[model samples]
Every structure is written in structure tokens, then in C-alpha cells.
Target: MLSGIRIVEICGIGPGPFCAMHLADLGADVIAVEREAAAGAPSSLLNRGKRSIVADLKTPEGRELVLKLIEDADALIEGMRPGVMERLGLGPAECAARNPRLVYGRMTGWGQTGPLAQAAGHDNNYIATSGALYYNGTPAEPPQSAITLIGDIGGGALYLAVGLLAGILKARETGQGTVVDASIVDGSAHMMQLILASRQKGLVTGPRGENMHERSHFFATYRCADGHFITLGSLEPQFYALLLEKLGLRDDPRFAGKQWDRARWGEMQAHFTELFASRTRDEWSALLEGTDVCFGPVLSPPEAAAHPHMAARDIYFERDGLLQTRPAPRFDGQAVTPRPLPQRGEHTGAILAALDAQAASVWG
Candidate 1:
């Protein structure tokens, strides 16, 4: 979908490369600039589908090469501290001077103008401040954090990708560029809108794991006879009825009609825990996997890759001795075949030659 769009990515860790990977998956021509010393280093899966070039941005000549690429590119993505890019002479103003239509995507943990913008932080710190990590787990447990999912991937990478694309669209229409401040703190807070609304409506109450969906028996994971886990999400009335019937508890007074009764949740959870443990996960899956009871067996990564449903969709595959994910949000049933990850600075000579030719055409 982005076949002809050219992007210059100033390589960094985590969210920056992930954003560039998304653009590249959508068919953008992305050139990743790497440090000369690490030019031949092994790249990660996030750098797949990008062409690499070696350059020391600390040097004038190397910085000039990147500036020249920006002059002819539609966008640039960089993840750096607030003033880091400016110090390197590749900040928004400098790049915009060369290409007014370029979208400058700035990815950072705290955003460009906040009080914490200059402070160093990681995914956990960002999500904590944004309220994304304050309400998980049980009330007794400290709010747990996943491995960079909420703040880094969901907040930082995904938002940066959207900002870059939206900026690109506006630039194309008006011939004017935009500086996208795609920050983890900002994005994470924005994603909490639904939860905040729920709180205001009194749909959820208190701190930590007080919400019905988090603690209730009908909406949580349960252990089985084999020690494996399964999940249930029978929140609606009809689904709740199905769940009771499937578990042979339709006639039991405790579970027959009290799904929304908050006071009886502990009792309900105990009942579910005991009942679900009567059978193995596989046995429960056989009885309720595809029904309106909203049940599913919890599978690990390798097991999930081999599940019939995931296999049918070809969601995971083995390539180049690595288990890789297919490009997401397929275009009309067509997914981008993920290319092999490029070695750092693999295309330096070829890219420089192309740049030379373009320069000659303009000034010769």
C-alpha cells in the first residue's frame, strides 16, 4: 500500500525499528542508517525488510549523507532523547529545511516537551505514569507489567507508525511537513480513555484488581485437573446461561442467576475453581471451546503456533532457522512475506551510488 514511499530511519533500539518495520511491511522503501563500526553486525527481526547503510552521524560527512537522504525522502523515524537529535543536526527544523514535505517522526518515552522529557526512562516507567500499569493483577499483588507490550509496542511503536503515516498524508496534500511527537507516555494515557470512561460510569470501582472482569469467576483463567489453564469470559446473560448449563450448574442456586452479584464473587470463584479442576484442560476444551460460554485453553508459544486455528491462518512460520511472525493487518488477504533481516550497513555502497547519481542529475 505504501509501495513508492521512501523513508529514512535513524536506527535505534526497540520502538523505533518496530515502527519502521511496520512501514516496510506495508511496502515502503525504508533505508536504515547504522553506525559504521556495527555496520556488519547481525540485525534483529524488527529490522527486516529494511535496506541498511553504514554512517557515523557524529561526523559531518556521515550526517550530510543522512540529510541528503532526508531531502529526497517522504519521512524519517528516530527514537532519541528530547535534545539528542537536535545535537546531531538532524532534528525537525534542519531536516524540514531540506524537505518541507517530510514527516519527522520522533519516538520517545516521555514526549518532547514534558517535564520528564529529558529524564531517562523505560517501558515500565512510562506505563506507570500513564495509568496503564496501576490496575492489573489481584488487589493483593503489585500491579504487574508485561514485557514492554503496553508502553513500548502498544503505546510507542503503534502510535509512532500512525503519526508518521498521518503526517505523511497531510504532507502529501499540503506540501508542508509535520513533526510527530509520538511518545509512550502520551499514547499510553490516550489508550486509557475507555477505562477512564468505565470508571466515571461506575462500571469499574476501586484500585488494582477490583473490576468485575478482573476478579470474577466468569471472566478469568482457571486451573484444570492436568494443571493446565483455561479461560472464561461469559459476561453476558446468555453466555452466562450457557456456561452454567455446560458446567451442569444450571440448577445450582449459587451459580444459576447471580452473575452480577458482587458480594457473591468469592463464592462463585471458589465454585468455578473446583468445577474447572474436575477435568483436564483438553477435556474442558472439548466441551466448551467453540460455544458461547467463551472458553479457551491457554496454550504456550510453541503450542499456540501449532494449534489448528492458528495453523489455518498461517499466523506463525519457520524461516531462516527462526520462528518469525507474518506481517500483520494483511491487505485484502495478502500478507507481506517477511524478508530476511539485513546485516547492518549491507547496502552502503549501493545506496551511496544511487545518492551520487541523484546528486549528479540535479547539479550536473
Candidate 2:
């Protein structure tokens, strides 16, 4: 739906590229600016479909080139830490001075004006400070990181993409641009609102494994006979009944109408541990794959790419000899596949020539 929008991304390591990739897939024209060294690297799936430009942000000419690109862009995204852009002369104030309608997007681990804004950190540190990491693992262990998904991709990339798009809309309507401070810490904290509410209402509580969402027999993972694991989340009453019937436990006196008996959860889970182990992952999946029991097999990345569902929908594809995911959140059941990844500075001359041609035409 975002067909004609234009985005210029000052490429960084993680979230910035991901956010730009999402935009490009949604039909936006995305240009990626990279350092000279980075531009020379081998094909990365992250740089797919972007017109890659190699520029030295530290050099005056390079900085000026980026400034010129920003002049006509609907939005500009950057993931540098606090004061880094200002030092490079590409900060929000200067960019806004050039084009008042430009949406300036700033991405960071900590927010632009926080105590840790200037501190060096990563996704783990941001989620750690946001109280998000505390609820992940068993209480016996320190909080698990969830491997940067919760902070870097979910909190950082997704939020920046949403903020930039929203700001672009407002700018187009009122000709008044805005700055989006898309901080991973802030987004991670915001993400906890739902769980925080659940905790307040006593629906979700205790240390990690003691909560209903975690420890309950109907909402846990079980090991199969083959040593692989399968997960279950038969939360609703009908689904719970179905699971019990499928497990041949409906007639067992131990589970007769004991769904919410929290005191019996451990016993129930123990029973499940023994029972599910009787069958292999394939066996259990064959019995309850597409049912209302809310089940999915734990799959590695390659396995997931080869899954039947993935193959049917083309969720993953090959481009330039690299495996990459298709654009997500389709529009009217349609999403665009990104073009091939650009080589180092592949479109530098073309982009510069196009800009000069447009400039000359307007002036002449």
C-alpha cells in the first residue's frame, strides 16, 4: 500500500536494515547508504532490494551527498547512538533545516534522552533494563535473552518502522515533519504492558515456571520418544477437553474437571511428561497437528524453511544465491518479493546521474 513512499536509510548493524527491508517490501523506494568498507562486503540478505551507495560519513563530500539525498526523501532513518549524527553533521536539526517535511527517525538501544543514552549497549542490555528479560526463563536460571528477537527485532526494528510510517503520513498531511525516537529500551518496556496488566490481575504471576502461562500442564512443552520436543497451548475449555480426549485421559479420575486446580499443575505436568514421551514427534504431530490444541513442532531455521506450510506459501525464497524471508504482513493477500541484493556501490553512478538530471530539468 505504501507504493510511492521514499526512504533513505543510514545503514547500521541490526534494526535499521531490517526496518528498511520491511519498507522496501511494502513497495517503498529504499536507498541504503553504507561505509566504503561495508559496501565491499559479500552479499548479505539484509541489503536486498536496496540501492547501495558507498559514502564516507566522516568526509565532507560524503556527508554532503547524504544531505542531498535527504532533501527529497519522505523519511530518513538512522541507528547511531546519541550525538553521533550531530557530530557527523547529519543530525535531525540539520536535516530538518534542509527539508521541513522530512521525517527524521532515530534508533538506539537506549532512547535519545535517557540516562543510558550515551552508553554503549546491545539488545540484551536494553531488554535487561526494561524488565522484559526477567520473565523469560525458569527461576532457577538467570533471565534468558530470547536471542535478541524481543529487543533488537521486535522492539527496535518493528517500532522504528511503525513510527517512521506514521510520521510520514502526518508530514504529508500537514507539511510538518517530526522526529521519531525509536528506542529499543522504550519499545521493550512498552511491550511489557500486556503482561504487566496480566500480572496485576493475578492471571500471570510467580517466578517463571510457576505462572499459569508457563507451568500449567495445558501450556508447556513435552519431550517425545525420539528426544525431540513438541509444545502445547490448549488453553481454552473446548481445546483442553479435546486434548484430554486425544491423550485418552478424559476418563481418568486424576484429570476429571481439574483444569484450574493450580495446586495440581505439577502433578498434571508430571503425568504429561511421562505420557508424551511414549510417542515420537512425528507420531504426536500426526495425531494432533492441525487440531485446536494449538500445536507446532520446534523447528530449526533450515527445517522451518523446508516446512510444508512455508513451501506452500513461499514464505522463504532464494535471491542472488542467498536464502531470505519474503516481505511480511501482506496487503490484500499480496506481498512483493524484494529484488536482488546490490553489489558494492552498484548504483552510485546511476543515482547521482538521476539526481543531477532531475536537478537540471527543474532549473532549466
Candidate 3:
């Protein structure tokens, strides 16, 4: 969908490269800039489908080369603290001045103008500020960080890609460029909209694990006889009834009424704990897979890769002896082929050759 678009990615950890990968997957011409010292480093899955070039922005010539690439590009994505780009002489203002139609995207943990914009932080810190961390984990335990997936990939990379595409559409229409400030904190907070609504409606409870979905037996994970886990999400009455029937739980009066009542939650959970322990995870999966019982076995990474549904969907791909997920949403009736992750600065010569040709054409 993004054919003919040219994007320059200033390489960083986590989200920036991920956003660039998405663009490249959609057929955009993406060039990733890596530091000379970092050349020949290990390949990263997030940097797939991109040509890489080595440039030390600290040098005047290197900085000039990046500016030239910006002039010929449609967009630039960078993940850096507020003033870091400005200090390096490649901030949004500098880039946009070179190409008025450029969509300059900045990805940061905090917003560009916030008090914590210049502070050092990571995904855990960002999600903590957004109340997302509060709602994660079991009701009895302190909130566990859900890895970098939520704040970095979900918030930063996905939101930045959306913002960049929106900006690109507007720039195409107006012939004017803009800056996209995509903050992980803001995006994470935005992701909690449903929880906020539940709270406002007085349907949610305090103290973390007491909520209907978080603490309730009907919507949580349970251990089976083999010590493997299974998840349940039978929120509706019909599905709940189906789950009860599947587990032979109809005789229990404790789960009979007021599914959302906190007073009976403990009793319901205990009843479920006993029921789930009678069977293994595989047995439970067999009983629940085709029904509306909202059940699934808890799968580890390797197990997930080999899951029947995942295999049918072609979700995982092996390239260059490395396993990674394929680009999402099959396009044009064709699956996006997985490309091997690039070694740092792998395509420097080819990318610079193309840039040199463009420069020579302009001079002529």
C-alpha cells in the first residue's frame, strides 16, 4: 500500500525499528541508518526488509549525508529523547526545513513537551505512569511488568506508524509536512480507555485483582491436573453456562447467581480450582475448543509457534536459521514473505550508491 514512499529510519532500540519494519512490509522503500561503530553487529528481526547505511551523525559529512537523504525522503522516524535529535542537528525542525513535505516522526517514552521528556526511562516506567501497570497481574501480587510488548510495541511502534501514515496522507493532500510526537506513556494511557470506562460506570473494583475480569474465576487462568494452565474468558451468561456444563459444574450453587458479585467470588474461584484440577490442560482444550466456552490452553513460545491454528495461519516464518513472526494481514491475496534480518550496516554501499545517483542527477 505504501509503494513509492521513501522513508529514512534513524536506528534505535525497540520501537523505532519496529515502526520502520511495518512500513517496509507494506512496500515502502525504507533505509535504516546505523552508526559506523555498530556496523556488522547482530541482525535484528525488527530491522528486516530495510536497507542499512552506516553514518556517524557526529561528523559534519555524516550529518550532511543524512540531511540529503531527508530531502529526498517522504518521512523520517527516530526514537530519541526530546533534545537528543536537536543536539545531533537532525531534529524535526531541521529535517522539515530541508523537505517541506516530510513527515518527521519522533518516538519517545514520554511526550516531547512533558516534564519527563528528557528523563531516562523504558517500557516499564512508561506503562507505570499510565495506570496500565496497575491493572496487570494477579489481584494478590504486585503488578508485574508485561514485558516491553505493551508500552514499546503496542504503544510506541504501532501508534507511531499510525501517526506517520496519517501525517503522510495529509502531506500528500496539502503539500505541507508535519511532526508526529508519539509518546509511549500517552499511547499506553489511551489503551486503558476500556478500564477507565468500566471504572466510570461503577462496574470495576479497586485493589487490583478484585475486578470482574482480573480476579473472577470465570475470566482468569486456572491450573489443570498436569500443572499446565488454561485460560477462561466466559464473560457472558451463555458462555458461562457452557463452561459450567463442560466442566460438570452445574451442581454447584456457589456459581449459580450474581456472576459479578464480589462477595461470592472466592467461593466461585475455589469451586473452579477444584473442577479444573480434575482434568489435564489437553483434556480441557478438547472439551472447550469448538464451544463458546471461551477457553484456551496456556502456550509457551515454542508451543505457540507450533499451534495448529498458528500453523494454518502461517504466523511464524524461519529465515536464515532464525524464527520470527511474519508481517501481519495477508495482502493482495499473498502472504508477505519473511526477509532475513539484516546485519548492522549491511546495505551501506548499495544505499549510498542510490543516494549518490540522486545527488548527481540533481547537480546535472
What TM-score would candidate 2 get against the native? 0.95
Write the residue-wise lDDT of candidate 1 on 1-364 in tens digits. 8989999999999999999998898889999998776435678788899998888899999889999999989999999898888999989999999999999999999999968989999999999999898877766678788878899999999999999899999999999999999999999999999889989988678767778767798988889999999999898899999989988889998887788888899889988899889999999989998899988899987788898888888888887788877889987897568777888888989999999999999999
lDDT of 1: 0.89
In model 2, what lDDT does residue 16 have? 84
Better of 1 and 2 by TM-score: 1
Better of 1 and 3 by lDDT: 1
User: Largest TM-score belongs to which candidate?
Assistant: 1
Q: Give the Å error, residue 34, model 3.
A: 0.6
For residues 1-364, what per-residue lDDT tens digits would candidate 3 score against the true structure?
7889999999899989999999898888898998786435786788888887889999998888899898878899998778888999998888888999999999999989967878999999999998888878786778888698899989889999999999999999999999999999989989999888989987675767768877788998899999999999998899988878777766667666667777888878888889889999999888898689888899887788898988888788777777788887687767788555677887878877887898889899
Kindly list the per-residue Cα lDDT of model 2 for residues 260-341, writing each as its tens digit.
Answer: 8999988998999999999999899899889998887887777778989877888887755667788889778875677778
Worst-scoring 10-residue span by lDDT in model 3:
249-258
Candidate 2 regions with alpha-carbon error over 4 angstroms: 38-40
The candidate, 2 or 3, that scores higher on lDDT is 2
Q: Which lDDT value does model 3 have at 172?
A: 94
**Candidate 3 overall Cα lDDT vs. reference?**
0.86
